[model samples]
Target: MPPTSVAAPPGAVTAAERSLAPDLARGVMLLVIAVVHAHILHTLAHGGAAPSGVADTVTTVVVLAFGEGRGYPMFAALFGYGLASVYARRTARGDTWPATRSLIRRRGRWLFVFGILHTLLLFFGDILAVYGLIALLFAGMLVRSDRRLLVWGAVWAVAGTGVYALVNNLLVADVEGATQVLAHPLTDIATRAMTWPAMAPLLLITSVFPFLVGVWAARRDVLTAPERNRALLARTAAVGIPVGVVGGLPYALVSAGVWAAGPGTATATGWVFMLTGYAGGFGYAALIALVAARMGARRGPVATALAACGERSMTSYLLQSVAWIVLFAPYMLDLAVRVNGTAAVAMGVGVWAATVVLADVLRRAGIRGPAESALRRLTYGPRHSARGAAAGQPAARR
Candidate 1:
C-alpha cells in the first residue's frame, strides 16, 4: 500500500500532457470496434447466415482473422493504462492510497451505471459495465508488486481462455438462435436486462488478463514514452501480430467455409483463436505507438483527426450504437436483412469516418465530448477544475 498521506487530488490530464500514441491507438481501435460490433450485430439479425457469396466469404475470413476477439482486449488494456495514470497522478500529488482507491471505485460505479443505461437503451453487448465491475473489484490490485501483477495476469489468462473455449463449444448454437432484431423496443430492453448481468461477469473474467498487462506496461510508461521503448515495441509488434494472424487462420478457414472440420476440431480452433487474440491486441497497440513515434511532432490532418476521435472515444462509441439502432433495427431502417457482410463492413467504416470528422470539428471548437464531459464531472465532482494546479501544473482546458 502507498503511504497514507492526504493531499488534494490531481486534476484531469491536459491535451498538452496527453500522449499521442495512446490517443492514436484508441482512435484506430474505435474503427476496429465499430466494424466488429457492426458485423456481430448484422450476423445476429441475419440469424447467423453462412457466407453466401464471394464477398461475404472474403469478409468472413478477414474479420475472423483480424477483427473479431481483437478490439475488446485492446480496449481493456487501454482502460488499465488509464487507471494506472490516475493512480500515478494522484499519488504523485501526495494523495493516500485508500483515497485514490475510493476515487477509482467511485468512477467504476458510475461506469457501471453508464453500461446499464447503454444496455437498456442501446446495445446489449455493452462492455462499460464489465469494465466498471473490474474497476470495483481490482482497484486494490493496482498497488500490488509488478511480479504479482504478471503472475495473476497469467493465471487469469489461462482460466479465462479455458472458460471462453468451453462457452464457445457449448453455447455457439444457443447464441446463434438468440437473434435480436429489435422488433419491439420493450422486448429487446427486457432481454438485454436479463442477460447483461450474466454476461458482464464473464466479460470481466476474460478481460482481466489484458487489463493487468496494460497496468504493467503503464508502470514503465510504455505508451507514453514510445521513443524510449522503441526496441521492445518493435519486437512485440513483430512477434505478436504474426502469431495472432497465424493462430486465427484455422478458425478463419472454418468460418469462411474454406475448410470443413469435425465439431471437435472447430472447437479447438475457436479456443486457439481466443487465446492468440491477446497477442493481436497487444501487437496493434505496439504498432500504432511505433507509427506515432515516427511521426514525432508532425501532426497531419488525418493523424490529428484520429487523435481527436480517440480523445473523445466514449462519445464515438455511443454514437456507433446510435447508428446501429438507426440502420439495423427492425423497427428502423432494417438494413440488416438487405446488407451482406461486405456491405455491413463498408457501412461501419462510413460511420467511423463520420465520427472522425465530427470529433475534429469539436476539437476545433474547443468543446469536449458530451459523454466525456459528463463522465469527468461524475468522476471528479461538478466543481472540480480541469486545472492541474493542485499538482503544481498549468491550468488545463477541458
Candidate 2:
C-alpha cells in the first residue's frame, strides 16, 4: 500500500520540505547575474567600446557566450517556478483561485513599486520592475493549460525576435552615444530616466518566453521531481547549452571585433544572439537541477549558505545593484573608467561573496531577509496567517 501523506499549513514549508535544486540554482545564478549586470553597467557608464586585445577579446567572448543572455532568462524562469509553486500551495490550502490570485496580484503590485523605486534610485538596468509588470500583465494567463502555455511561449519567442530585430536595427547608431551621458555625474540620472521608457518593451520581449517556460516546468513539478526526470534533464542540458552557445557566437564575435558591428550587422545578427538566451537559460537551469539531484539532501555550511542566499535572492539582487551604484556611478565612486571588464567582474564576485556571507548570518539567526519578510507580510496579511495556523492545515505535497 502507498504511504499516506499529510499537508502542512499554507505558506509553512519547513527547510526540509523545500527542494534544494531551485534554491541552489538561484544562489549560483546570482553570481552570474552580478557579473553580467556589472559588465553592462560598466560599459554604459563609460560608453560602449569594442574589446581591444586578445585577452580582453577572450574575456568578452566568454562572457557573451556563457553569461550575457543566459543569466536573466534563468532568473526569470526561476521567478515563474516560484510563482507557480506559490499558486500551487495556496490552492492546496483550499484557498479559492480568486483569493489566491488576489494575494498574488497584491504581491505583484508591490514588486512593481519596488522595481520602480529601485530603477529611479540606483540602476536603470533594473529587472524587478519588469518582472512585476509581467506578473500583473499575465496573471490571468498563468492558469492556462500546459499546451496553451507552450503555444504562448512559442508565440512570445517569435514575436520577441522580430521586435528585437527591429529595435536593434533602429538603435544601432544611438547605442554608444546614449551611453556617453553616463560619463557625467550630473546627467547620468536624467539619461537613465529618459531611456527607461524605451527599455521596458525590450525587457518584456527578452523575458516573456522563458518566464512562460518556467511556468510550464513548475506545472510538471520538474525541479521537485528531478530524480524521476533525470533523463529529461540530462537531454535538455546536453542539447540546450551547446545550441545556445552556437547561437550566441556571432554576438561574441561582434563584441570581440572579429566581426564588425554596424547598423546592418547589429540589426540582422543581434536578435539571433539575444533570442538564444532562452536555450542557454533553460540549459543552465537543467544542468543545475541534474547537479542538485546528485547532491541529494546533504546539509553543510556551503549548501546551507548557498540555499540561504537563494532564499533571499531579492535582497541579494538589489544589493548587487546598490554596490554597482556606489562603486561605478559618477555621483558615487565614479570608477567606471578606472575599472576594466576584468576588474569589474572581480568586484562583482566580491559583492556576491559579501551577500552570501550576509545571507548565511541571517540564516543562522533564523531571520528572513528584510525584503523577503516585507514581501511576505505584504502578500499575506496577519489575519490570513493566523487563520492558517489555527486551522492546522497541512502543507502542499509537492
Candidate 3:
C-alpha cells in the first residue's frame, strides 16, 4: 500500500552534494546541441543544399559523426540519470514509491508545460516535453527490477531504430519543407504549434532507450563514483565512440556530396548512423565521466565553468533557443540564409561559449537559474520551494 502521508520530500540537492561528472556532461552536451540545431536550421533555410566548401564538408562530417543524433541521447541518458537520482534520494529518506512517483509525474507535467511554451515562443525542436511525457508514462518503472529496465530499454531501442529508418526512407525529402521558416511570425508560431505534436512522439520513441540506460547506470552510481567504474567506463568509451564515428561516415559522406548513393543505399546507411549514435551518446557520457574522475576534486576554472552551465542546463538551453530565433528566424536576423554551413557551425560554438560565460556569472552571483527555480517550485510546491530557494539547491534533474 502507498504511504498515506502527503508530506514533501527534502529540499533540492545542495551544491556540495552535487557530483561534477554529470554536470560536466550536460554542459558539454549543450554545445553539441547548439551545433546540431544550428546546422539543421542552416540546412533547412538553404533547402538542404550539399556542403559548399571544404570547411562545410568537414563541419558536416564531424557534426554528423559526433554531434547531431548523438547529443540528445546523451541528454536523455542524463535526464534518466537525474530522475533515478531523485528516486533514490527520496526512497532512501523513507518516502514511499507511490509518493515519489507522484513527485516525478508532477515534475514531468510541468516540464511538458514548459515544452509547450518553449515551442510556441521559441524553438519547435524542444525536448523538454518529450522527457516530460516519458517520465509521466514510465514513473512506475523506477521501482522495477534492473532486468526489466534493460529488457524494456532494448525493446524500445529496436523499435526506435526501425521507426527512424522507415521515416528516413519515406520522408527524407519532405523534412526540409516541413521545417522551413514562414515569412510571418504568426504563421511560424502556428506551424510550430502544429508540427511539435507530431515530432514529440517520434522523438520520444528514439529517446526512451537512452533514458532507461541512464536509469540503470544511475542505480549503479556509474557517474557519481566514476573511479569505482573505471574499467567499465574505459571499455564503453573505447568501443562506443569509434562505432559511432564509423557508422556515421557513410551518411555523412552522402550528405556532404563526397560519395554518391542511391535512395536505397542512403536509407540503409542512415539507419546504421542512427543505430550507432546511441553508442556514441553513451560513449560520450562515459568519456566525460572518465575525465571527471581524473579531475578528482580539482575545480579548475574551465571545469567549473562547464559544470556551472551544466547545472543550469535548462536555462542555458532556453537561452540558446532564444538566440536561434533571433539569429535564424526569417522574421528576425535571418542569418541562416546569410551564413554558410561553416559559419553556422562557428556561430554555434560562439553561442555556446557566450552561454558558458553567462552561466559562470550566474554561478558567481549564486543565483539559481530562473527556469530551474520555477521548475523546483512547481514540482515541490511553495513551502518546500521557498526553502530550496533560500538554500540555493537546484532540483535533482536539470
Best by lDDT: 3
What is the Å distance of residue 319 in model 3 from its true position? 0.4
Model 2: weakest 10-residue lDDT segment is 389-398
Q: lDDT per residue, candidate 3, 1-398, as tens digits?
A: 23212334362565546789999999998999999999988987887778888999999988898787899999999999989999999888888888888889999999999999999989888999999999999888788899999999999988897787667556656764454677789998998899896788878999999999999999999999999999999999999999999998998998888988888888888878888999999999999999999999776889989999998999999999999989999999999999889899889999999999998888887777789879988898887776655554332223
Off by over 4 Å in 3: 1-11, 175-179, 393-398
Q: Which sections of candidate 2 miss by over 4 Å?
A: 1-16, 178-187, 382-398
**Between which residue pairs do clashes occur in model 2?**
7-394, 7-395, 8-394, 8-395
Question: Residue 13 in model 1: shift from native, Å?
Answer: 1.1
> What lDDT does candidate 3 reach at residue 332?
93
Q: Cα miss at 255, model 1 (Å)?
A: 2.4
Candidate 2 lDDT, 176-261, residue by residue in tens: 64453365644766766776788877887778888888888998888888998899899889988997899888878886678877
**Candidate order by lDDT, highest to lowest?**
3, 1, 2
lDDT value for candidate 1?
0.84
TM-score of each: 0.93, 0.90, 0.94
| Top TM-score model | 3
- Give every collision pair in model 1: none
Q: Which portions of model 1 miss their true places by more than 4 Å? A: 1-11, 385-398
Ranking by TM-score: 3, 1, 2
